[model samples]
Target: MIKSCAVLGEQFVFRSLKEIMAKANEARSGDELARIAASSMKERMAAKQVLANLMLKEIREYPVLSPEQDDVSALIEEQVHEEIFKVIQNWTVADLREYVLEDQHEGADLLYIAKGLTSEMIAAVTKIMSNLDLIQAASKIEVKTTCQTTIGMKGVLASRAQPNHPSDNLAGMRASLYEALSYGIGDAVIGINPVIDTTENIYALLNETKSIIDEFQIPTQNCVLAHVTTQMRAIEKGASADLIFQSLAGTQAGNESFGISLSMLKEATALINEKGTAVGPHRWYFETGQGSELSAEAHYDIDQVTLEARCYGLARQFNPFLVNTVVGFIGPEYLYDSKQVTRAGLEDHFMGKMHGLPMGVDVCYTNHMNVDQNDMDNLSMLLGTAGVNFVIGVPMADDCMLNYQSLSYHDIATVRRILNQGPISIFKQWLEEYGIMENNRFTSKAGDPSIFMNGVLGGMK
Candidate 1:
């Protein structure tokens, strides 16, 4: 029965071909042939209605939560409704029949129908259909509605953990971040720490880093770096900086404190500005990994708002010209916490105030906590939605590595046969076709040599 339904669905694609050809080959005047074609097309339309009703009925029998049944039914119904509506609203039967009979009809109708479907609809349908086998592979786990509601109410900390290994993770993260920056994916700010801790061999590292940045040639407005610090000088240096700074909740140790480390940053910014080789217009330097204290959080919030106001006070700063970048850090404890107040506070403040600055977070470092795969998935999706412009790619991270695999779908058959291969790769290929794959790169070879520039930066011109 299932096989028959599948066959029928496939048959629908070619159902009108025979009638179309018959009308084209009929021995009659053009007008008479067109009339006959219209009548025949009407009959075929009636049959399609029946087929649509049958498909919908079959769909209704399956549970709403059932993936296969719901997805197939939804897709069929959506297609049928769209096609029928176009026939009724725009095309005469003769026009459709003629288009159908021809080897090419320009594909305008198909494109129109495709555009009518929303992203949400496609995602929902894909999720339902793709998870069918997984549903069977894993035993069902049920949670009470109350429990689900409670989970939903919790903050970012209640979220799952990330991969272990700071260096490896940072590599992957840097890739993701680079990708995001290149493509203008979301809200992002790239922060650079220009000064290395030790003076012994710092010149090489700084030069290397600068060389890399120059090679990439990304817009200077999108990047900023912090200053170097010394143990005793750090305190005064941190306290004396003119710009406001913010950092992550929980993780600060010793001389690595958040608010008090600005003096060094000030020196760095001043030197870089004077040198004219540094990327600046630097108004802020966010401290990543500072343990959360209520006092600290409040101070952070006040400082951010105050800085924004100051920028505005200086010169229509509230307008679009004020270039600023806020660097944030995400770790296991923060992801696993039940109350994500710190994340929420920063989000609320920065989201509205920094109208034009690119904002992002670095998740390359390892947390001393456990994180699951699902957590990573959720975090990615969440950040994508939260106006996060760039994410450090998993493959670029030092810890988590990508397999650098590629798959080709040369035709419809290949697409239909895709089973466990996630749709992400398929979409990436589509993006590549349009030259939009920089941020969507799934494989290492997919990198584009051109530096990604944001539309906003271009708009400045």
Candidate 2:
């Protein structure tokens, strides 16, 4: 079917809803590479005009992929609350956008709206939103989840201690963890991206991080970013994992490329719920990024943003404790540079929050990307302001193993103070116990990792 709209007396016709979605997006290299981006600015506007008038029911009916052909699509269809959907089914995309921006419809209202939307409808609204539009609307919604500790509270920003080592060296990782802890970061989880994705290496890293938590009595969780199956295998072999980690995609074929499936995720969740050490459910950690589906050649001609939203659609079903978009790690081919990266970061955060998931972002870039620490700084502050659940903290904003740049411990601490936010409540109490923080601000002894070594700071001891 064809969709047509007129802009300033110029008629433009889009081949399908999928094409309209691609055309409506802000300039993205991946969309251009996929040859789905609009050929001209006028054409893009026309697409947006058509999309803005599209009914929620129409978007739901013309899914980019049919449910029978794609399990991800099926899952999304299965989760929509029919009673809720029927109420707002006639609303236009423009109406949905205005509703989110409206002051009266807040976090609870948005969560209710989320149950009535599919990933496509969410993507449709995002395509029409500007950066500030994304931020302002996202700030109104707060999605909190808990595993070992509760995160995503209002006026709180969390950080993941990514103590990654090039060789999976436990001591080296620990040194980074200490630095993160000293700065009162890592309240979300102590996670590692292992160089070796083997079960043995994953098991060892999980045990090492769990041991650190046990020894220090830290109110946090631990995880290794290996394949979900490998994490499951390690857990079966007696690895004490606080959360099982996996990277998700929006399509069945894309997930297949990642060696995951709906059934695999179901199995992993059940395993963690039973054997994992976390309390009160919400024990899964998932990561996503734009262009992953295209990179795997499984995108089916849909735009990256919509596929990215679908990733969140898949994640919400399992009640994940954490889900972040590694915004710039996909590099120049997809995100192109800092501007694109920044846009994607904001988009991912807003989309995830709209899905009612506890969302965060890995504010990072590869070495080859036309990005630097300044861009990371800007994006982090924006996301922090938008009430993101957490951000990744590596040593000095650099991950030695992953070979990328992200927020550092010091950077996170600085952001928290500037934004008048702090870590999770339990983690803040622990920080106070060690004198690392006082009155929602860092003390003189904050930056020294040695405080944890002695189990007590100077005044207490």
lDDT of 1 by residue, 340-368 (tens): 32232233223222222223333332334
TM-score of model 2 (CA atoms): 0.98
Query: Of the candidates shown, which would achieve the greatest lDDT relative to the real structure?
Result: 2
**Which ten contiguous residues of candidate 2 have the minimum total lDDT?**
452-461
lDDT of each: 0.28, 0.92
Off by over 4 Å in 1: 1-196, 215-227, 230-268, 276-280, 288-357, 363-367, 393-444, 447-461
- Measured against the true structure, the TM-scores of the candidates, in listed sequence, are 0.34, 0.98
lDDT of 2 by residue, 1-461 (tens): 33998888889988788989999999999999999999889999999989999999999988999999999999999999999999999999999999999998888999898899999999999999999999998998988888999998999999999989999898888888988999998899999999998989999999999999988789999999999989999999999998998999999999999999999999998999999988857899999999999999999999999999999999999999999999999889899999999999999999999999999999999999999999999999999988899999999998888888999999999999999999999999988887888888888999898876666775664
lDDT at residue 272 of model 1 (Cα atoms)? 37
